[model samples]
Target chain A: MIHWPVPEPEIPAGTHPALAAVARAAVAAFRDARGRFDRTQLAEKVDMGADGTPTTRLDQLVDTAVAETVDAHRVNLISEEIGVIDNGSAVTLVVDPVDGTSNAVAGVPFSAFAGVVAVDGEAVESLTTWLDTGRSWHAKAGETLPYRTTGRRELDGAAVSLLRPHPKSEDAWLRVSRRAGRVRVLSSSCLEAALVAEGSLDAFADPGSDTHRIMDIAAAAVLLPAAGGALIDAYGRPVEIDPDLSRRWSGIAAATPDLAEELAEEINRPSS
Target chain B: MIHWPVPEPEIPAGTHPALAAVARAAVAAFRDARGRFDRTQLAEKVDMGADGTPTTRLDQLVDTAVAETVDAHRVNLISEEIGVIDNGSAVTLVVDPVDGTSNAVAGVPFSAFAGVVAVDGEAVESLTTWLDTGRSWHAKAGETLPYRTTGRRELDGAAVSLLRPHPKSEDAWLRVSRRAGRVRVLSSSCLEAALVAEGSLDAFADPGSDTHRIMDIAAAAVLLPAAGGALIDAYGRPVEIDPDLSRRWSGIAAATPDLAEELAEEINRPSS
Candidate 1:
C-alpha cells in the first residue's frame, strides 16, 4: 500500500468548472487505485493506449474516471489513453489523466493530473495538480499568473529537468545535461513544467526525445506564457492545441524565450 | 514564495521521542526559512560546512534547528553542516537536516529531513520525513517494519533511482541506467532510500561517485534492513554510523542483498 493518502487539490476559485471537476475526479480515482491495488497490480498492463503505449491498471482507472467526468461537463476531451472523446462542444479538455503513470504506480510520488481547456483549437486555461500532495498550479492564457518564472535567459547556469533519455536521443540529452548547472530526471513532464512556471526550475525539456504528445504539453503551452515563461519544440515545430494524438514534440518549457532557444540550440549541437 | 505549507510528519507513535522532537524542529525551521527567504537568499552559501561542502542558507538554518533540538535532548549529533556535536552521550543522532538542499531552496519539493538514532556506533532506529509533503518512513534496526521490500534480486527489469552522474562516474551511471527498466534522478538521497526501503524502487544508488557522507546514508543502514532491504557501499566498504563527516561512500540501497551486489558489480564494471 502507498499508505499516504492523496490530499485534495487546492484549486483556486474561478477555475473552469469542467477543468476543476476533471482534476478532482482524477485525484479521487488515483487515490482509490492506490488504496485497492499493490504496486505490481497497479502497474499491470491492462490495455494498449491510443498513444501507442501500454496503459497500466492505475492509468486505466484514472482515465476512465476522467473520461466520465469530462462527459458530465459536456466537453470534448483529447487525452493520451482515450485518444479523443468528441461531444460536439467547442470546449475541449486536453488532459493527461495520470501524467506520470509509471511514477504513480511505482509509488514514486511525482505523478500529476494535467488538463488544458481549449476552445476553437486554442488553449485558454490549464491546471496541473501534483497528485500525491494535491499542490496545484493553475493559469489562464493571456492573464498574469500570481506565480512567475525565474526569467532566466541562458542555459549556462540553469537548473534543467528532463525526461529520461531514449537511445536515439542520448547524444542530445548528454549535450544539454553537460552544459546545465544542474540536471534532474524527475520523470514527470507536467509536474516539471509546473516547477518551471513557479520559478522552481529554470526549464524542463525532452532534449530532442520527441516524446510529448499533445496532452503531455498542451497545458504547459498555456501555463508557461502566463507565468512569463516560454514553451517551444526543440525542432522548431509549433506547439498547438491539437486533437490529434499522433503528433508529438520535443517540448521545452523554460523561464524565458532566450533560454528555451538556447536549450534547443544546445540539444541540437553536435557531439565533439 | 513557495506558498504551499509544509504539513506535520505522520511519525509512528513508538518512535524515539528525541528523534520526533528533532524532526519537528527541522520541519519548523525549514518552514520558517521558506517563509523568510527568496530562492536566491535561501540558496546563498552562508558558511562552509564541516563536511567540506558549502552550506546553503537553508541548510544552515535547518542544521542549526536540528542541533539545538539535539542539545535539548542531551544527545550527541553527527550531521552534514554542523558536523559532530559531542555532548558525551552514548546516543548520537545522525542527520541530514535538508537532504536535498538545492531542491529545497529552489522550491523543487524533493527535500527531506533524515535522521538515525545511533548507540555507541550502530544505527538503531531511523526516520525520514519528506519535508514538502510530511510523509515519513520510520524503522528500528532489528525489528520488523510494517513496510517491506519488493524482494527483487536482480538489476535487469528493475526500477532504479540514482544520483545525477558526475563526470568521473558517468560511465558507471550509464551502465546501470541502460540495464534497468526505469531510471530516475529525483535529487534527494534520503527520500530515494526511503522509497527503496518501502519497495517503491528496486534500488537507489550513487553508481560510483562516492558522494555520500555518513549522514547521507546512515538512516538507510537501519531502515533498509528493518524493511527487508539491504544497504551497502558499492566499493565494498562497510557502511557504519560514524562521526567522521569526511568519510564518503557510494551508497547502494536495494530490495535485497543480491540486487545490491548486482548494482555494485554493474557500477564498478569498465565501460565497453
Candidate 2:
C-alpha cells in the first residue's frame, strides 16, 4: 500500500549486460528444470549435505551452470554449496542459486528464487527475486530499496508462527496473539525474512534454526540491513555471514535491531 | 500435501446450465468493477455499518444482481448485506458478494470471490467458486480435493495468513514464518480462510477479524466441510446462517478442526 517513490543511483560504469543476461538465462534454466519436475521428482534429486541440510542435484546443477556463466565477470563469489571462490577482486558477488529448497522439493509454487548481493568487503548491496512468482526486489547504495522498516511496530496481539518453534512455542504464540500480531506458520525462512524487510511482516524468528546455510543468509545479509532490518543468532549474537557455512550458528531473529534484541531478551528471559 | 479426494458428486437431475452461467457472469462483472476501481475508489463507494463494519454500494449491487438472476431457482437465500429472504424451500443458497472489503478498498489484490454452498438443510455439499484471480475451485462429495497438512489432514502448523496481525503485526509474520509451512498476508480473510479448506493454506485466522458477513462463509460452509474442513467462530461454535445477515460475527478460523482449535487456544490463552 505504501507507494514510496524509488530513487535511482549511479553504478560502476561497466558493461554488465552480459552478466545480467546470464543471470536471466540461469533463472530461465532453473525454472525450466523445475517446471519439468514435481515434488516427488525433486525429492529423488536431493541429497543430505555435510551440515545435515538437504541439497538437491538440481541445486548443484543450477549453481554450477550460473557460476560458469558469471565466472568471467571477474567478481569473487560466495555460494551455498561451494564456499567462497575469489576472483582477485575486492567486490564479492554473494549468491544463493536457490533459496527455498524444501518448497521446490515439495512442488510448492512458492519456491524458485535467485539472489545477488554485491559486497564491497563489509558493505553489501542486495538483489533478490522470487523466481516462481517473479517478484523482484533489490537495494543498493543508490536506490531507495524495496525493503525498509518502521521500528517500534509492536504486537497488536494475534496468533503467530515460527520456523523452529522454540521450547516455548506455545507461550510465544499465546503472548504474541494477545498483544502483538497473531501467529501463523509458513516454510521458506528466506522469503519470510524478506517479508519482514518489506514491512509486510513484523518479525521472523527461528530456534534450532540451523536450516539457513551460507547461501540463504548471504543474500539476506545484504537485503535485510539495506532495508532497515537486522538479524541475530540464537545465542543472541549478530548473525553474520558464515563464509564457511560448514559450521552451524545458533539461530536467527530478523527484524529491527531494537525489536530483535527485545524479543531475544523475552524468549531467553527466565520463566516467571 | 493431503489429496483429500472429493470426486464430483451427482449434480441434481435438473441442475440448470443457465443458472450456473448467470452466476458465473455476475462474478465476472463484479471482478471487472473491482479491478477498475483501486482501494481509494472502493473506500468512497462503501457505506459504514452501525457495528463499525463498512459496506460498499458495490457489495449490495453485486449481491442483488446475483440474487435476481438466481431468483427463479426456488432456493432459500442466506447472504451478507440482505441477510436471508425465505421463499420457503428445503434447499438453501449462501452467497457473499465480496469477501475482502478492507483489502478491496486498500488496492490490495487479495479480494474478489463468489461462492455457492447448497445443502438439504442438514449436511452440506457442493462448494463452487470464482476466487480473487478468476480461478475457480469446485468440490463435491466425490472428488480428489487438493490440500496439504502436516501429519493429520488439517490446517494445523500450516502456513497461515491473517487479515489482522496478532500481538504485533511482526509476530504474525514470525509465527507463520516459524510454525506454518509458509507465511502469507494475502489481505482477504474470506479467500484466505477458504484456501484453508481448499488446502491452499494450512489455515486462516483472524483475531481482530471482522468484515465477514453470512454470505462470506455461505459457499465455504458447503465446500470446506465437504472437503473435510471446518470454519468456526471465536468460541469454536458453528457459524449460523440467518435468513438476514443483520449481525456480523466476531471473526473466523477456518482449518481442520484440530489445527483451528490448537491455534485458537494458543491465540486466546491469557498472556503473562
Candidate 3:
C-alpha cells in the first residue's frame, strides 16, 4: 500500500465554487482509495471511459466522487471517464479527474486534479492541483497569473517535459529530446503544464502523437496564456472546449508564442 | 522559491544512528536552502564536486550539513560534493546528499537523500528519503525487507524507469523503452530505485549511459538485495563501495536477478 497521505491543495481565495468543490472531492477520493487498495487493485482496468480508453479503478473511484460533487453543485462536467454531464447550464467544468492514473495507482505520487471553468463553451478560468503535494496553480483568462514563465523564445537549451514515446511519434520525440538541454517524461501532463506555467520548465509537448483530449489540455489552455506563455497544437489546430471526448491533438505548451510555434515546426519535421 | 515544505523522514526503527543523523541533517539543510534561495540561486553552480562535476548550491549546502553530521558521529564520509572525509574510522557513510539536485532546485519535487553505512569497505545498510515528502526506505544487508519486489523475471511487459536519453545512449535507451510495457524518465535515480524496492516499479536502468558514480547507486546496492531484487552494472562490472569518484557505471536495479541480467544484455545491444 502507498502509505503516503495526500495533502489538501493550496487553492486561492477567489476560485470558482464548483471548481474548488471538484478539486476537494478528487483529493479526498484519491486519498481514501490509496488508503484502502494496493497497487495492483488500484491500477486494474475497471471499465471503458468516455474517451474510448480503459479506465483504472482509481480513475473510476475519483470520477465517481467528482461526479457527485458536480451534481451537488448543479454544474455540467465534461471529464475523462464520465464523458459529458450537460445540465442545460451555461457554466461547465472540464476536468481530468486523475491526470496520471498510472502514476497514482503505481504509488509514484505525480498525478494531478485539473479542471477548467467554461461558460458558453468557452473556458474562462482553470485550476490544477498536484495531488501528491497539494501545490496548485490557478488562473483566469485575460488576467495575468501570480507566477510567470521563463519567457524563453526558443527550444534550444531549454528544459522540456514530454509524454512517453509512442511508436508513431518515436522519431518526433527523439528530435525534441536531442535538441533540449534537459528532457523528462514525468507522465503527468497536467502537472507538467503547471510546471511550465510556474517557470520551472520551459515547455511541454506531445511531439506528434496527437494523444491529448480536450480534458487533457483544457486547464492548460486557460492557465498558460495568463502565465505569459502560449498553448497550441503540434499540428496547428485550435485547443478549445468540446463535449466530444474522441477528438485528439498533440498539445504544445511553452513559455512563449515563438517557442510554441518553433516546437510545432520542429516536431513536424520529417523523421530521419 | 519553492513554496513547498520538506517534512521529516519516517526512518524505520533499528537504523544506524549515524545514518539517521545524516538523513536528518540533509533534510534540514535542504529545507533551509529552499527557504532562503530562489530557483536560480539554489541551482547556481557553486563549485566543482569531488566527483569532477559541477555542484549546485543546493548540493553543496546539503553536503556540508551531511559532512558535519558525519564528523559529529565520528564516521568517515564519501559523498558527491565533499569527496572523502577520512576520519580514520572503520565506519563510513556513502551518500548522495542531493540525488536529483536539478529537480529539487527547479521545484520538481522528485529528489532524494540516499545514504549507505559501510564498514570495512562493505555496505551493510541503506536509507533513502524523498526530500520533498520525507517518505523513506531503510534496509540492512542479508535481511529480508518487509516490503518486497514484484519478482518480475522478464522485461517484456515490465514497468521500467530510465534516466533521460543521452546522445550516445539514445538508441540503447529506445531499445529498453520500446520493449517495456510502461516507460518513465523521472530523472531521480535514488527515488526511482526506491520505487523498485517498494514494487511500484519493476526496474530502473541507465540504458548504457555511464553516468552513475558510486554515491548514485550505493544505497541501492544494499536495498535491492534485501528487498528480493538484484543490482548489477550494465557493463558487467562489480558495483562496490569505492572512494574513486571519477569512476562511472551504468547501474541496473531490477526486481530479480533474471530481469537485471536481461536489462544489462539489452542495454549493451548495438544501436539500431
Candidate 4:
C-alpha cells in the first residue's frame, strides 16, 4: 500500500510533431493490447522474430500496432518482428513494441513500450512508456533534461542491474558482482536504463552478449545521455544507432561516463 | 494501461482475528510511510537491525508501527529490527515489516510487507502485501488456497528468479541460470515468492546464502505449499519455520516438489 506519485508523461516541447504523434499512437496501441494480455494467449508462440527469438501472440499483436502506427509517419521504422521498413525518410524510428516480453506475459509488471527517433543515424528524440503503470520518460537531443543520475563514483555499495550472463561471460559476471555491493537482473534493458537515468540504479550492464539490438537500446541511448549519464559498448566505445535490425552489441549504461568506463573494465577484465 | 484485476486480500475465515488485525495494521503503517519515501530519507542509516544489516529511517519507522500494532495482541513477535518480543503466548508472529528494503529505497516498486503466524513452532497463517501496489495474497494452512503455480515441471524454458548470488555462491548461480530458460534477480524474496504462487514465475531460489530469515520466507512457506508448490532448503529438506529471528537458511520455492528438488541438485552439483 505504498502510495507512489502517479507519473505523467514528460514530453519535451521541441520534439517533432510527427514523432510525437507516432509515440502517442504507439502508447495507445500498447494500452489496448495490455488490457487483453491473457496468460494463455501470451504464451502462444506465433512466429520467429527477426532477431531469432520466438514471438509470442502478445508480441505479434503489439508489434503490428506499433508498426502500423509508425508507418503513418514519414520516417523509416526499425523494429524486432517486422525488421526494417523503408519509408524513404531522413528520420528512422527504432521501436521495441514490447521490451521484457517474458515479464509482461508472466504478469511481472515491469515491461515497457519504447521508441526512439534518430536522424541520419543520430538519435534526436526518445520515449519509453511503462506498460504496467502509465508513467513515461521522454527526452529530446538538446532540450533541458528532466532527470539526472546520482553521480556516485565508487563501486562499493553501488547498485547495478546486469543482464543474466551468457555462458562465455560467466566469469566476467562473477567479477563484476564481486566488485559491486548489489547486483540485480531485471531482464528489461530499456527500463533498467531508465532506472539509471532517474538515479534509481547506478548502472545497467550486458557483459558479453550481443543480444541488444538498436531498437532495444536506442531509447536508452537518448535517455542516459540527456540525463548526464552515458551508454557504451563493452570496449567503452559509444554505441551506434543505425537502422540495421540484424546487428547486435554488448553495452552498459551508467550514471556517469567515468562509472561507465569503470564498469566496462570490470566486465571485460580477465578472470583470475 | 494493463487492466490488472484489483487484488483483494484473500483472508481465510479460519485465520485468527488478532493475526488479521496485525496484518491490516502492518499494511496501514506501510502505506503511510510509502507516501513520503524520498530517496534521501530512505538512505539515512538510523540503526543496526537485529539481523546485522543497517536499518534505514524508513525501516525503523515502519518496523515501529508494525511492532507496536502486533504487540497489542497476545502473541510473541520475532522481527528483523527487533530480535524477539516475548509476550508469554504460544502463538508467535514472524514479520518482515519491509522486505526488499533496497528496492523500496530506490523506487524499484517490487518490495513487500510480509508476515506469518506460527502456533507452537508451526506456521499456520501467512500474508504478503505488495508495498508499491495494494495487491495482497494471504493463506492459512488448512483453508483452500487463493492461487496456484503453473505446475511447469521442466527446467528448460522455465522462468525462474534467483537472488543475485553472493560471491561465495557464484558457481551455483551460474549453474542454476544455465539450466533455466530465463533468469531474473528481482531482489525481493517475499514478492518473488508471491510471483511463484500466482504463476507469474516458475521458481525462486536463494542458492546458498544465509540471508533469508524466517520473517522473509515465512509467508512464502505457507502460500507456496498451500498453492500446491513447495519451498525447501538448499539440501532439499523442508525448511523449519521456527520463530527464531537469529537463524537463517537458503531456500527455493517452486511450482512442484519435483522442481524444487531438481533445483536443489543443480545448485549443489559438483562444478566441472
- The candidate maximizing lDDT is 3
Assess each model's interface with DockQ, reporting 2 decimals per model: 0.84, 0.15, 0.78, 0.66
Model 4 per-residue lDDT tens digits across residues A11-106:
556666656666566556555555665587776899998777789888888778767766777678888887788888888888898898888777
Task: Give the alpha carbon lDDT tens digit for every residue of B203-225 in model 3.
Answer: 99999889999999999999999
Error of 2 at B163 (Å): 10
lDDT ranking, best first: 3, 1, 4, 2
Candidates ranked by DockQ: 1, 3, 4, 2
TM value for model 1? 0.98
Q: How good is model 3 by TM-score?
A: 0.98
The prediction achieving the highest TM-score against the true structure is 1
Instruction: For candidate 1, write residues A1-272 as lDDT tens digits.
Output: 78778999989898999999999999999989999999889999999998889999999999999999999999999888888999999999999999988899888999999999999898999999999888888999889998899999989878999998789788888778778888899999999999999999999999988899988898899999999999999999999877667798999999999999999998888877
Error of 1 at B268 (Å): 0.8
Candidate 1: residue B266 Cα off by (Å): 0.8
The sequence of per-residue lDDT tens digits that candidate 1 reaches over residues B48-83 is 999998999999999999999999999999999999
Model 4, residue A214: distance off in Å is: 0.5
